[model samples]
Target: MPNLLIIEDEAAIRRVLSKILKEEDESYQVDEAADGVEGVKKIKANDYDLVLCDIKMPKMDGVEVLQEIQKLKPEIPVIMISGHGDIETAVDTMKKGAFDYIAKPPDLNRLLNTVRIALDRKELITENKRLKRKVSKNYQMIGESEAMTKVKDMIEKVAPTEARVLITGENGTGKELVAHWLHQKSERAKKPIIEVNCAAIPSELIESELFGHVKGAFTSANKDRAGKFEAANGGTIFLDEIGDMSLSAQAKVLRALQENKIQRVGSDKDIKVDVRVLAATNKNLKQEIADKNFREDLYHRLAVILIEVPALNDRREDIPLLITHFAEKIAKEQGTQVCTFTNKAIKLLQNYNWTGNIRELRNVVERLLILGGKEIDDKTVTQFSGK
Candidate 1:
């Protein structure tokens, strides 16, 4: 059943429209608003599927009401009613975001059909969002290496509880991938996963970015905004490249972990968050701690369950399997036939030092697929790999 609002100033027309809509479908719960001002007020106060608004009214015009509706409740579809003389104004309303136009003394069939189409479109939008969330929920850990297998086992054992996970690995070793798998497999997966790339955000803004700020708190802070911790209230937050976080930010992070609360920048009131933190780093944190680059207390707090990802070279035995997997995936992505790699070519690739790790391997595979002939062999590897 769809909830509908009728914002026609004419009492007789409102009654007639309401009777027609209800007669067409008894399940539709319709309400009447006397004018555009009242219509905008109702929209802000409640959620509705469709709104039927008149083109002219006292205090606020239909176009102004439509703009306000879009600003506050953009998802609700609005069908504007215009008299024959108001056709130009109704077209102008469409440019301002009105869904569709209905002539004054609406044609019963046309009005009902338009309402049905708008309702169906809204349903489809909601369904598509739901399917997208389901797809994101299915972000499984993908790898066949023994290292990855062990990591998956660890995630299974640790996900049921609220222990902090510290994922350590070299650059391009899929540390972020492990973090995602941990959150998706954990009990908190149903909750939101707010991500914070400590290195990507500027150090000066990191504090406000994580803890939020009150209106007029800073030079550019125009309004009160919720921080990362507040946004991830009931779920997990993956802090990528945490080792690069500023010393001051690290102090705040340690306090949040210790107290389960965070105080916004330039504010004293602490906000509690039920967020499970998953931190990842490519640097040796122990060394960073020694150099005064990282906090030792935060280190112990985050490293409760350290899951180190082995570099590609450390797991040479998995190279053939990873190569074949990447080859098939790349072929499908490129819409080309999968090329066959000789045993010797695979062996040569396995022996090479993959300084950039698995990411580099995938790039090489793509290069070979694009540049090498139908069969990728040792000669192609020797030429492309600069061996």
Candidate 2:
């Protein structure tokens, strides 16, 4: 529900504003205050989505009320209610962070439009905050083991540069996490980071997917569309599993890296893209090159800075920390209490062969939280962990 506050000293004006607002939208939970003092009190007590304050009120005025709101709850947008001669004050209020002002006897269209736009902006701001929190959690680097520390140090050093990075690791070793950390810490952090899993996408359509295609370029190319390179312009593009990319697509990628330009499938015209490419692969590119399945020149272009993520087995000392992290993460996602494990249980889990790496550890931890006792024990790990 949209909770609104109407703070006017005059009883007649308050009633009019309330009537106009409630009739406009019944879902509006409108609250009333007799003066600016009462309005500030109400605002301090409850969370209001929007506040409508009169400029010339007894006790405190709207300007002072707005200043107080700016200090108290700046997120709650305030709209000044101006008298006929208070246009200058109304304009001035906007410069100080007021959302907008409505003249006395508010116009139905203007008042409603301003409120709607303000609410929409508030929703966007709220959503962006939530996304930022989520992103931080998702990209968090969680381990202090020597091997993990080295990787963290590399990210801190390499993320500031515009170098092409090749992240080599086995499946489930969290290669994409390194890619995300790089983008988050780089100068182009404000821009988008577009990711494409080369192995997941078929070889036949890889070219079209990377460089786009015009209408009638292929049976499914019904409309002109931009590709990943174009979308990642002035930002970063993460090519996951690049060793699986087709030989022909590798040629175009080589050209893009060499000339900073690419031609869409079935289009001879070259489109320039200022994109920093980050690639990852589980397979050995050298072996692939000898097999005549990968391009050596493209490998050289992408391997300017190579980051080899260690397997979970190599960093077994970090298992306890990872388990605790996963338990809390799972609790937050599932809206439950964080589950704890006994030291014996932790030892048992850490001894297991972690061929599937950190990704597999998280899954096992989630399973334990779901099925194990409140305080998980060694026996619980034995019974529930399918290891």
Candidate 3:
């Protein structure tokens, strides 16, 4: 149910607004405040989806109340009710933070529409906050080793710039995480960050995937579509496993980098794009260039700032921290308490070779959470960890 607050100095107007809101929807819980003081108190005490405040109250006017609400709870949408004489003041209040302004004799349709819009805006704000929390949790970088620390420092320094970043690391070393952090921390954070896995897509279709194709360009191309670069306009595009990209696609990508433009498959016209490019590959680009498997020009274009993620075996000291982090995260996902790992268990796990790196470690942690005892000892680690 949506909670609403009506802060009107006129008793008749207060009753009318409450009656109209309650009659409009049985789910709306409307509360009335005689003046601004009482309204501020109620607003501070409760969470309201919308607030209707009179612009010309005796104790404290709507503008003062809106200012207070801005300080107390800026998320709550406040609508200022104003008379003919207070119309200018009501508009000023909106500039000061009021969500909207309603006339002295509120129109039935206008009042209802305003209320609905305010409630919808409030819901959207709440949902966006929730999603931001989830995204932050998902992209959390967990490691305090020297190598990890250097990567973090580089991200801080380089993330603010428009320079292309090429992350180099072995498979499963969390290259994708670095790309996400860079986008999340950049000036283009508000825009989309489109990710394309070059290795996952077939060589034949890679060009069409990166640059959209017109209808009949390919058998699968039925209609015109926007490709990843167009979708990431005014944002960032992360090309993962760029070493595996075909030589033909590499030539097109190099052109896009040099000209800040791309031509769709089967189209001669070029579409200009403003996208910050970030690439990552597990393969050694120099070796790939030597073998003529990858383009040297493209590699140089993408590697303006190189970030090499350390293999898990090299950062064994961070295993304990990673274990605790993964344990808490897995517990939350599983709706269970976080299991503890004994010191001996930690030591044993750290000594083992992490062939698959952090990706493998997270899976092992989840497995232990399911199969190991409440306190995972060295014996439980040996039995379940496949060591």
Candidate 4:
């Protein structure tokens, strides 16, 4: 049941509001307060979906009550009830954070409609907060090692800025995970983060992939399409495996970074884009630049805030935690009971080389969970981990 509070000095008006709300929906549990002081006490004692407060109350005014609510429980939506003389005060209350204002002798239709809308808005806000929590958990960085702590510190410091980020790490070292964290934590968290793997797309088609092509730009261009850069406008674009991008595509990426503009493949018209570019590469970009395989200028542009993800082998202390995390995750995915790793098994597994990093660790954990007993032991680790 949705809880509602009516704070009004007028006993007659308070009764009317409560009656109307209960009549509209019997499920609504309405509470009444004779003055702002009583209202603030009730607000602090119980959670309310919506608050209907009178703007002109004696002892303590509605505006003052709203201010207190804003300090105490800002999430609760407050609707100010105003008389003909208090309309201006009601408007000012809204500026101070009241959800909406209801005029004197509240219109039946308007009052009910506003109440429903306020409740709906509150529901949407609650749902959004829940979803954000789920997303944060999904992208959580799971290590307490010194190397991992440094990465987390860097993310906190750099995520709020508009500077470009270049994540460097070997294959399967969770470079993409770092990119996701940066985008998720940044000011652009609400905006989309389009990811494009440079090595996955063919060299000939890489340009068209990054910067859209006209309808008749090429033989395969049957329709006009927007590219990754345009798609990521007002957001972020993660260029994974950037070292493998063709020189032609590299030049366009450089131009885009330089001018915040891009020309679609085979199109002379320049299209402007407002995007944060985040690139990742496993290969040594400096060496690539030395060999003339990568553009030094582009490297400079993308490396404004470089984050190097440490290899899993270097952070061996995190192996035990990683094993538990992966075991629980895989069990949930497979709808099976979570398997456990003994201390001996974990120590033995940590002693082995983690050439593939976290990705490799997760795979090995999954294999052991499937092939070993519920309590994975040292013998089971030796059999399934292939260490």
Q: Summarize candidate 4's per-residue lDDT along 18-73 as a digit string, tens digits.
A: 99989987889999999999999999999999999998888899989999999999
Assess the local accuracy of residue 4 in candidate 3 as a C-alpha lDDT between 0 and 100: 95
Instruction: List ranges where model 3 is wrong by over 4 Å.
Output: 1-134
lDDT of 2 by residue, 1-387 (tens): 989999999999999889988987788899999998999999999999999989999999999999999999998888899999999999999999999999987898888867766765565455445645666767878889999999999999999999999999999999999998998999978766778999989889999989988667999875456678877778889999999999999999999999999998878999999999999999999999999999999999999999999999999999999999999989999999998999999999999999899999999999999998789999999998889
On lDDT, the candidate that comes out on top is 3
State the weakest 10-residue window (summed lDDT) of model 4: 123-132
C-alpha RMSD (angstroms) for model 2: 9.8
Q: RMSD in Å for candidate 3, one decimal?
A: 9.7
Error of 1 at 78 (Å): 15
Over all chains combined, what TM-score does candidate 4 have?
0.66
lDDT of each: 0.86, 0.89, 0.90, 0.89
Candidate 3 clash figure, as a count: 0
Give a tens-digit lDDT track for model 1, residues 98-157: 889999879998898788767755664564446438538544455677877898899889
Instruction: Specify the poorest-scoring 10-residue window by lDDT in model 2.
Output: 123-132
User: Candidate 3: deviation at residue 234, Å?
Assistant: 0.9
lDDT of 3: 0.90
TM-score of model number 1: 0.66
